[model samples]
Target: MIFRPIVPQELNAVLAQVRPDPSTAVSADTVRARLADGEYRHRWIWVAEPCPGRAPLAVAIWWGSPADAHPSNLDALFARSDPMWAFADLRRRTSSAPRPTTDPRSAVAAALLVAAHRVFAVDGLVPAPDYHLLLPSGWRDRPETAASVAWRRRAAEGAGLRLTAEQLRFERAADRPVPSLSNRLSFTPEPDDEIFVDLFRRCLSKSLDTTSTRKALRIGAEEHARDEIAFYRHGTRGRRSWWRIARTTAGQVVGFAIPSHNSVVPVVGYLGVLPEFRGRGFAAEILAEATRVLAAETRGGVIRAETNLSNHPVVAALELVGYRDRTRRLVFSAT
Candidate 1:
């Protein structure tokens, strides 16, 4: 079998081979747009072929930097592979399709997985064991669709990956009732990244991101905090505004909040309290302050936030501030 990056000229042909459900195929226009779009690093789209000149068996595409890319919804762009001696195909086809026929998707998917990991290593990208799979809100009810997703999940596990956590997205509208402030904590315009780094490090004692990072990559918590400082700094795509530091009346540090705009939508980038200051409701206050800061700028608009499912406190705090549940995403990892 021959596996390699699909050439631009052959993109349309390879895309034609991807027999996805209606409305899921990547259009030619979309491909062109991504090529022209500079914000994201559109890594190479890979394809696998059976033999010297046979048609492709599967394809895989991911978003983000090559080494650390996340799977978009269409990650399963698998090319049908021949029936294999594997239980994955047997188990996945149970509910999704008629058992009388062969399921080539799994065969193609397994090949693509091996190829993808090899390319990831060759390209010097940060290694992640698994790619995230997005299961829509009503996935379980749709038996056929859910079956296909389950098949992909099994294929992922076959490649030594496992389901991790659901990253829940939450949103608060500008109309959320803001707590009246007596200025008990002072908010400052902005400060150096180093200052935020120290506070973030302090918060890492029980941080979900830190825990996940440790489990996934075996990195220390301090390394995770520094990476977070870089992330919050670069993740803001719109106008860079005040990244506030909240302090007490006596000028002691209370917490920090990042209120910024990503493109047109205002966002609560990051809000955290010192580990020693937990249980006093500092998270909600910082969240509310950040919400107010963004809300004032965006009338009746929304402030978006995402927290890992494991972080119950962050989710509770978001709910306290009128942040409704928007959506949930499953994060899968493998090595």
Candidate 2:
């Protein structure tokens, strides 16, 4: 098979070949919308074809901020040897499909990812972009869901994308009452971005965020903090003034909250409590304050946030503050 980026003229044919899967939520309309909005560029979309003149067997779509020089994440992946593969075909082959053997789709997808990563690296994008696969809540408990995810997981791992973090996605609708907050902590906007970086670095001491913690371990805390600050500053659509440092009424800095937005919707950008202030129930307070800030500004639109599934404290805080569990996101990255 030949792996390469798709041309603009081939987009319609390429999209027509893939089957829709709700788990990935990568429908043609959605792909078209993102492409139109600059989140998905032609160069970021790759495919594996039998030959130069044939139809693509698999397609990989990457997503990035409009301002980003390179794509940040793999949003959708679809592969099938048969161009007609769909729900009917999947249902017909469900019982006969061999579980132990590697799926042909997986093989093609792996080749596509490997080729795409090499090109991205040649262009100076080091450490391949992460691949995010969204699974339903309790997906592991469902046999069909588990089986479907297995092939994609194998494809990702085969392409050197190690399973890094599993996150619990949460969404709070505008109708959900804004969580109440106590007067124990006061939030004030800091004009300096450096102050937020220092606090972000301090919070890393006992952070449960798998991605950031791993980054700090690999590149040191100081640089990791600066990387994160720059990401939020330039990559996201959120305004800088939305950031606030949370402190006790006595002027003791407890934590910070960032009420931010993405290209799609508002999000609880980031929040962390100081190590010394842990176990004082400040996380919920800080998160609630961020939610309030976003709600007022967005005029009660939906706000989303995510936390590492292993981070029980943050998970509990999110639950307590009225954010409903939406889905589980499995992130794979090349280390």
Candidate 3:
């Protein structure tokens, strides 16, 4: 087998061989653009050659952070390829200087861990003691495996890590009673400016409980705000773009939902209700309204969202509206 860096010319070939469908957002062109823009630093696109007469296989996409530059990111593009084998390949490429373990257990899991370690290594990155893998609802009820759990823990400990178990909660849409409210909240799409900023600040202030969680969520929200604004300002190439849905009541801005057509999935960039509007089910209402709009725009697809696991209210609100729990993203530090 041979491992080599992919060049711009080979991107289309890589996508053709690896990508599930030509319409996926993580295409060769998209990755190349990110690499060109310096977002994807210390990255390697690897293909595995078969022995003798077999066709070459696109094994994995390993991305690393420039700061740490650990060969960690490995996504098995070919279904026939074993993830563990790809992980071992990455391990061989990494320098043995007490480097953090790159996640190869699952697609992109080890990659993200390595990336975080690279960025926050100097700041003493702490792993979650034991990582929690959220299973789709009902996967836990029929479980019977100390051996399985032990194996997971052994893998982590062997890699100088630990593992734990926890239930991940998610919202799924179901026919439910909608609360009655007189606010008459409506969504109006517009550019994210001072008004949206203020709305975000207000919502975060009310929603986040702990000071640390608040601060972290605030930073994330701010960054997302900027990205949404940029996407709206300079529409993404080869994509449908939109910035609509502002929630207001009694001539006062309460909340808003920013939907864009940049990816294969229509993303809800930002959605929130001011502190003053809490308990009135405004958050759920706005999300439901956004879902309606998205359904109208697209035939049907999964709506992706991420929130700190600690935020119970937002999680509950999402459930109230009709989003399902997909996966729990475990973020770690290498330092």
Q: Candidate 2 versus the native: TM-score? A: 0.91
lDDT for every model?
A: 0.62, 0.83, 0.46
Is candidate 2 or 3 superior in lDDT?
2
Worst 10 residues of 2 by lDDT: 93-102
Instruction: Put down candidate 2 lDDT per residue, 1-335, tens digits, no spaces.
Output: 56788889988998886566745778888888989988999999998766577777789999998878899999989887453343234325434222233466665676678789889999998889999989889988988778767778877887889756889999998557776757899999998989989999999997888888988998899999998888888888888888999989899999998888987799999998999999988999999989888887775468999999999999999899999898999999887
Order of candidate numbers by lDDT, starting with the best? 2, 1, 3
Candidate 2 positional error at 77, Å: 0.7
lDDT of 2 at 206: 73
Q: What is the lDDT of residue 65 in candidate 1?
A: 27
TM accuracy, model 1: 0.77
Model 1: per-residue Cα lDDT over 51-167, one tens digit each:
545566666665442223443222334545454533244335333222222355654565566566666766664453445554545556878767766656655554445645667
* Order of models, best TM-score first: 2, 1, 3
Error of 2 at 319 (Å): 1.2
Clash count list over all predictions: 8, 0, 11
